[model samples]
Target: MHQPLDIKDKSSDKNSIKVEAFRKHVRTTKPHKHNNYFELIFLSQGHGTHAIDQEKIDIQPPMVFGIGKEQIHYWDMDAEPEGYVMIFRSDFIMNSHDKALLELANELFSHSHILLSKDESITQFFSLLAKELKELTVSPYVVEGLLKALFGKILQMALHIKPTQDKSKNLYQQLVDLLIENKEYDRKVENYAELLNTTPQNLNAICRKIENLTASEVIAAHIVKEAKRLLAHSNSSISEIAFHLNFKDSSHFVKYFKRHAQVTPGAFRSSSLIEKRN
Candidate 1:
């Protein structure tokens, strides 16, 4: 199982955030997921396909993509990409007292992507942020303020194209939340539908309408995600992991993993170890 890519601040400051030019650091084309921090990418120059949560989005320059924590994604770039990638933890924004900014951060993550027309001011914001990052003497408070301003700008752009609230979205989110919370013990779509006080058909329809996946697919995806995490990060044996996830047996677990991941559990673990070594 491929472990999610967890990028962390190596700086001495425990609550540190990171900002860097995109082209200088990103080299891989492999698909992966982030474990903790939210990622905000400003694409000033690039052409590629961004796969986020199983949706393929064509990368258009002068657009921004905000990825929430624990989301799976990858980039397939046709050319060298150039932009700024800002990664910060939720606590970075939570430190601020600005209620509106906090709400915008939540909204940005919920949406996952935004399209912005060519704007010099947005480009300038990233440039200034890069400069601040380079200055060793810049105070943490100043950096926090810059982050808030950047989020504020993103919020403004996001609001312009925000869609009206709908029942499908609400139902989908509720189902996803329940699946995530109970993935360890519950894998049945019917159980989730019952917990949400809806029929299996209704749940499936809402999931299909909102995420292009059936309710069973959504539940399995969450379970597979957790399984991958354990396979990559833990020292548990295959049988132990199977029992932990409430599988009937190790053979059944292996069959399920191969059906979904297209690789045996041991092979996945080996590949993940190789990637980590590199």
Candidate 2:
């Protein structure tokens, strides 16, 4: 069994945000999943493969990758990686109650990665962010404000660079959006199909075309992702997690987890705890 590494930011003040150059840190290059924070990585120079949720993406310079919390991922860099890594808790942006900001953040998280070319404005923003991170006396609000501006700019660039939209792709993106939004209460393909005003077969076909996975698999994957996050990061018991995820019974939840994860829920939790301790 491959245990996913749980990486934590151990800043002295327990700050909700962290920004640093990627090559400065020396750590093992292993498969891992972040616990509760989202990651935005800017790669200015690198050649490698980035695996996210079973999808392998080729590395290209001047690209940005956005990863939501608990998404399994790893890096295999053929050469030294160089760029800035910005990590911040999801609640840090959600709690702001700025609807536009929240929507932009959500949009960025919707994609596995975004391709970019060197732009002077983006470069200047990153430089400003790096400077702000060095000034320990800067207020938290100031830092957060800067982050919001950076995200806004990224969102704008993404909008312009997004590939031509088609009906099939749009529907597929909607399915993904709904999966993230309603992972707890609704886990049925038919339910999502009806919500999209399409039949289950049609929905499945769209999903297959977009991601090579059926609609049911997509829903199950999101549910399992959330379940793992709760097991690893929360103090919730197995029964509690089952209930929270709308599982009818703990036994059924265990079976489902085992079927996909190749380990029972209890065993997974125990291993996760042991990993944390080490």
Worst 10 residues of 2 by lDDT: 1-10
Model 2 misplacement above 4 A: 1-13, 24-28, 159-221, 224-278
lDDT tens per residue, model 2, 33-151: 77567788887778878977656789886778998765767787777777888888766776775655665666667678887745456666777887887786867677667777877
Cα displacement (angstroms), candidate 2, residue 130, comes to 2.5
| Candidate 2 deviation (Cα RMSD) | 7.8
Q: Write the per-residue lDDT of candidate 1 for residues 60-107, one digit (tens) a residue.
A: 777789876556667878767888888876667667676545555655
User: Which stretches of model 1 miss by more than 4 angstroms?
Assistant: 1-15, 24-28, 163-278
Cα displacement (angstroms), candidate 1, residue 23, comes to 1.5
Best by lDDT: 2
RMSD of 1: 6.9
Clashing pairs in 2: none
Error of 2 at 264 (Å): 16
lDDT per prediction?
Answer: 0.71, 0.73
